[model samples]
Target chain A: DQQVKQNSPSLSVQEGRISILNCDYTNSMFDYFLWYKKYPAEGPTFLISISSIKDKNEDGRFTVFLNKSAKHLSLHIVPSQPGDSAVYFCAADTTMGNQFYFGTGTSLTVIP
Target chain B: EPEVTQTPSHQVTQMGQEVILRCVPISNHLYFYWYRQILGQKVEFLVSFYNNEISEKSEIFDDQFSVERPDGSNFTLKIRSTKLEDSAMYFCASSERPRYASTFRTDTQYFGPGTRLTVL
Candidate 1:
C-alpha cells in the first residue's frame, strides 16, 4: 500500500527561481513529515521537516509547509540553485512507530 | 559532522547464496534502522533496532532476513537465502531518538551511502 504519494514524477525550473515539490499522505496517523534530497549513488540527506503541530518549518533556503486538513505537505526551495537538483523524497511517520513511508520521489532539475 | 557508514558499496551474489550487509551507525545514536529501495521505487523500511533488540519491522522483513548489533559499533543485516528480487540498494540509518519523544519534539534520521546488493 502506498501511504505517501508524490504525483509529480519530475520538475524543472530555471536557476534562481522558486521550486515547489508536493506530497500527500493517505494515513492521518502520520504526525511527522520530512523531506530528503538524494543524489545519484548516494543516500538521502535530510533537508527539512515539519511537525503536525506546526504549519511550517524553515532552514536556510529550504522550507517545509504542512496542511494537516488536506493531509498534504510541500517543500519549497527559494532561489533554486544547480546544487539543489536531485531526487526529492517526502516521508511521513506516525507516533506509534518509527517506520517512515516514502513517496515515489520528484526529480528536480534546476537549470543553470 | 559524523555520519553513518556502510561497508562494500556494492555486493553481487548468486540467487541462493547468503549475503550480509554491515553498517556502523553514529556512535551516540540510540536507534538503528534498515531501509531499501528497488530501482525506480520509493524507499521502504525493513526494520528498526533499539537497545540491541528489534523494536519494529516491516512485512518485507521476512524470516529470510535478520538484523543484529553484534558489537558495540557494528549492525548487520543477513539474508539467509537471497532471491533475485532481493537485489536493491540497502540503506542503514540511525537517529539520536525517535521522531517523537515524551519530552522532545523531533530528531532527524541520518542515512548511510547505502549498499547496492545485486543477487544474480
Candidate 2:
C-alpha cells in the first residue's frame, strides 16, 4: 500500500508566481515530513522539512504547512524561478525508525 | 562539503549473473541506507545499517540481496543473481544520527548520485 500519496503528477506555474504542491498520507504514525527535489539522473536533494509539533515551517521562498487533522501537507514556493523546476517528492517518517516512505513525486515546471 | 558517492554510475549485467553495487558514504556518518527507484516509480527503502549490522530491512530485501560494510569506508550491496526486474536506479544515503530531525550531517541522510543497474 502507498502510505504517502501525491495525487498530482504535474503542475505548472509562471515565473514570479506561486507554486503549490500537495501531499497526503494515510499513516497516522508518521510525525516528520520532508520534501526533496530531484533532477533527471540525479539523486534527490533535500528541500525543506516540518516537524509534527508545528503547523508551518518556512525557509526563504519555500514554506511547508502541515495540517495534522487532515493528514495533509503542502509545499509552497513564492515568486517561483525556473531553477525551482524539478520533480518534488514528499516523504514521511514514522516513530518506529528513520526509514522514509516517499510519494511517487510531482513534476513542477516554472514557465517563463 | 562531503557527499555520498557511488561507483560505476551505470552497470549492465546478464540475468542470473552476480552484480555488486558500491557506495562510500560521507566520512563520520554512522547510519547508512539503500533505496531503489524503478523507472517512473516512487523511491522504495531497501535496507538500513548501523554499528556494522543491519538495523532494519524491507520485505523487498530478500535472501538474494545482501549488504556489507567491509573495512571502514566502503558499503556494498550484492545481488546473488540478477533478474530482469532488478533493473532500477539505486541510491545510497547516510546520516550521522538516528533521528530524522537531525541535520543530514547529523540526522538527515545525504544521498549519492545513484547507480543505474540494468539486468538483461
Candidate 3:
C-alpha cells in the first residue's frame, strides 16, 4: 500500500555541486506534490511544491520538477552546502482528500 | 513566525493505559492534522480535523483513537488502552487552507516537533 516511494535511501554530494532526490507515486489522484526537509529531532520544514499542472517550480536554490506522465518528481539543490544535509520527504495530496501520503524519505548529505 | 507546537516531547506509558497528546496550531490556521511514524517507517496520516470535526481518517485511526479541538487553540489526540504496536512519533500539523479551496496553492503544511510515544 505504498502509494508514494523513494527508491534511494541515501545520497551524498560535494559542496558546490548539485544534489538530486527523487520520488515516485502510483496514485494518479494526487494533484499536488511537495518536498520537505527534516533535521534530526525536529519537525519537517516545507521546502517547495509543484502542482500536477506544472512541470517545474523553483525557489531560491531549491527546485522541484514534476512529470505527470511518469508519476515522478524530484528535488534539486544547487551549490549544495553542509546546512542542506537532512532527510527529505516527498508528499502528495489529492484534490478531494485532506490527508497526505508521504514516502519513506531520502537522506541527503552535502559534504563541505 | 507562528508555528505548530506539541507537548510531552516523549511519553512512556504502559500497555492498557490511556495517553493524551496535545497540540497548538498556528492562531489563524483553519485545518489541523495528526500523523505518526513508527521507527523505520514512513509518516502515516491518522486524522484531519476542521470546524471541530474530523474530515477524514485513516484505517490506522480506530475506535481507540480520537481527536478533539478542546479549545480554540488546542488540539488533542487520545489513545485509549494503548498497545505496544502503537509506539511511534506522533506529529501535529496545520494548514491555512483546505485542499478544495479555489486558491489552493498546494495547501502548504506546517508541522510541529513530534511527540515520541513509547508503549511498554
Candidate 4:
C-alpha cells in the first residue's frame, strides 16, 4: 500500500515558466511534509517544507502548499530555471518522529 | 555544512553473499535512517535507528537485514544473504530530531550519497 503517491511521473516546462509538482498522502498521522530535489547519481537535498498547521510556506523562488483536509501538497517554482530539472520527491513525517514516508518522485525537466 | 557520507559508492555481490553498506551521519544527529530505491521505483524506508537501537523498521527489513551503529560515527546496514531483487541504491540519512516545521527548526534530515548495490 502506497501511503504517499506522486501520480505524475514526469513533467516538462519551458524556462521562466511556473513548475508545479503535486503529491498526495493517504495517512492522516503525518504532521510534517517536505520536498527534496535529486540529481542523477546524487543524494536528495532538502528543498522546502510546510507544517500541518500552515497552508503555505515560501522561500526564494520555491513555495510549498499543504492541504491537510485534501491530504495533498504541492511545490511551486516560479520562473523555473534549467538547473531546476531534476527528480523531486515528496516526503512526510509521521508524528512518531524520525520515520519518513516518501513518494515515488516526479521528474521535472525545465527546458531552456 | 556537515553532510552525511557513505562509503563504497557501488557494490557488486553474488546472490546468497553477504553485503554491508556503511554510512557516517552528520555529527550531533541522533536519528539515523536507511532507505533504498530500486531503479525506476520509489524510495522505500528500511529502518530507523536512534540511541543505538532500531526505533522503527519496515516490513522489507526482515530477518536477513540488520543495522548497527558500530562506533560513534558509523552506521551500517548488512544483508545476510543478498537476493537479485535486493539490487538498488541504498541511502543513509540523519536527523537531529523529529519534524517540526511549526517551530521553524532545522530538524530536517540530510542524506548521504547513495551506495548502489548490485546483486547478481
Candidate 5:
C-alpha cells in the first residue's frame, strides 16, 4: 500500500540553515498527519503533527505544513544542527481507523 | 517522561522456532500496537490490541502470528513458526485514548526502542 510516500531518500543541509523535508500521500480521506524522527537502532520520535482543519502546525523549531487539496505535506526545521541528522518519516491515518500509514523515511544529514 | 519498554534488544533464532517478543506499554494507556520495519523498507503495521482483545490486524498478520496481554502490563507477539523472511525490527507502541471517545481526531502513539529479530 503506497498511500504515503517520501520521494526524497536523502537530504543534506549546512548547520544553522533551514532544512525542508517533503512528503506526499495519495489518500484524500486522511485527516491526520504526523512527522517522526528516528535515530539508528532507536524507535521513531514524534516531532509534529497537523490536522486537516489547520494548514500548519508549529512546535518550537519544527513546523508542519499540510495542503489537503494537493494531498501533500512538508516538515521544516530551522537552524539545523548536527544532532538533527536522522531519518524522518511522514505518516497519515483516517482517525477512527486507528491504523497508521507510513512513508519510506528520508534521511537528513546536517553538515557542521 | 514515562516510555514504553521492550525486552531482548536483539534475537537470533533458527527457522521453525517459536519466538515471543515482549513489550510493556506505559501505564494508563489503553491501546497497544505492533509494527515492523524490514531493512530499508517502510514501517508496516502488524496488529492492534485493546481491552485484552485484538481490535485490528493487517494481512501480514496471518495465522502464524498471535498477540496476547496475558497480564495487565505485558503485551507479547508470538510467531508460531519463524520463517527466514521474518528478520526485521519490531516496535511496540501505545496510545492513551478512550475507545468510545469520538471528538478527538487521533491518538498520538509513543513507540518503544525496537527489537531486532533475526531468523536463520
Candidate 6:
C-alpha cells in the first residue's frame, strides 16, 4: 500500500512565479515531514522540513505548509527560478522511530 | 560538509549470483539506513542500523539479504543469489541522533549517487 502519495506527476510554471507541490499521507502517526530535490543522475539533496507541532516552516525561498486534519502538506517556492526544476519528493517519519516513507515524487519544470 | 558515499555507481550481475553494495556514511553519525527505488517508483525503506546491530528492517529484506558494518567506517549490504526483481537503485543514509528533525543533521537524508544494480 502507498502510505504517502503525490498524485501529480509533473508541474510547469513560469519563472518568477510561485510553484506549489502537494502531498498526502494516509498514516496519521507520522510526526515529521521533509522535502528533497533531485537532479538527473545526482543523489537527492536536502531541501526543507516541518515538524508536527508547527503548521508552516520557511527557509529562504522555500516554504512548507502542513494541515494535520487534511493529512496534506505542500511545498511552495516563491519567485521560482529555472534552477528549481527537478523531481521533488515528500517523505514522512512515524512517531515510532526515525524510519521514513517517501512519496512517488513530482517533477517540477520552471519555464524561463 | 560530510555526506554518504556509495561505491560502484552501477553494477551488473547474472541472475543467481551474489552481490555486495558498500556505503560509507558520514563520520560521527550514529544511525544508518538503507533504501531502494525501482525506476518510476517511490523510494522504499529496507533497513536501519545502530550500534553495530539492526534496529529495524522491512519485509522486503529477506533471508537472502544481510547487512553488516564490518568495520568502523564501512556498511555493506549483501544479497545472496540475487533475483531479477532485485534490480533497483539502492541508497544509504545516516543521521546524528534518533529524533526526526532535532538531533538529525539534515532532517532530510543525504542520499548517495545511488548504486544501480542490474540483475540479468
Q: What does chain B score (TM) in every candidate?
A: 0.95, 0.95, 0.96, 0.95, 0.93, 0.93
lDDT of 4 by residue, B18-103 (tens): 99999999998888999999999988999999888998899999999999999999999999999999999999999887554325
On residues B45-116, what C-alpha lDDT tens digit does candidate 5 reach at each position?
A: 999999989999999999999999999999999999999889999999988873225444336788999999
Off by over 4 Å in 6: B100-108
**CA lDDT of each candidate?**
0.93, 0.93, 0.93, 0.92, 0.91, 0.90
Candidate 3 per-residue lDDT over residues B1-120, each given as its tens digit: 888999989999999999999999989898999999998889999999999899999999999999999888999999999999999999999998887784655367899999999999
Query: Lowest-scoring 10 consecutive residues by lDDT in candidate 6 chain B?
Result: B100-109
Put down candidate 3 lDDT per residue, A6-110, tens digits, no spaces.
999999999999999999999999989889899988888889888898999999999999999999999999979999999999999998888889999999999
Q: Mark the regions of model 3 whose C-alpha exceeds 4 Å error after superposition.
A: none
Candidate number achieving the greatest TM-score relative to the actual structure: 3
Candidate 4 lDDT over A1-112, as tens digits, reads 8999999999999999999999999999998899999999999899998889899999999999999999999999998999999999999987656677899999999999
Best by DockQ: 3
The C-alpha TM-scores of every prediction are: 0.97, 0.97, 0.98, 0.96, 0.96, 0.96
Candidate 1 steric clashes = 0
lDDT of 3 at B120: 97
Give lDDT tens digits, candidate 1, residues A1-112: 9999999999999999999999999998999888999999899998888879999998898999999999999999998999999999999998877888999999999999
Q: Candidate 1's error at A76, in angstroms?
A: 0.7
Interface RMSD of each: 0.8, 1.4, 0.7, 1.5, 2.1, 1.6
Q: In model 2, how well does chain A match by TM-score?
A: 0.98
lDDT of 5 by residue, A54-96 (tens): 9998888899999988999999999899999999999988857
Off by over 4 Å in 1: B102-106
Docking class of 5: medium
What is the fnat score of candidate 3? 0.94
The TM-score that candidate 1 achieves is 0.97
Q: Is the docking of candidate 6 incorrect, acceptable, medium or high quality?
A: medium
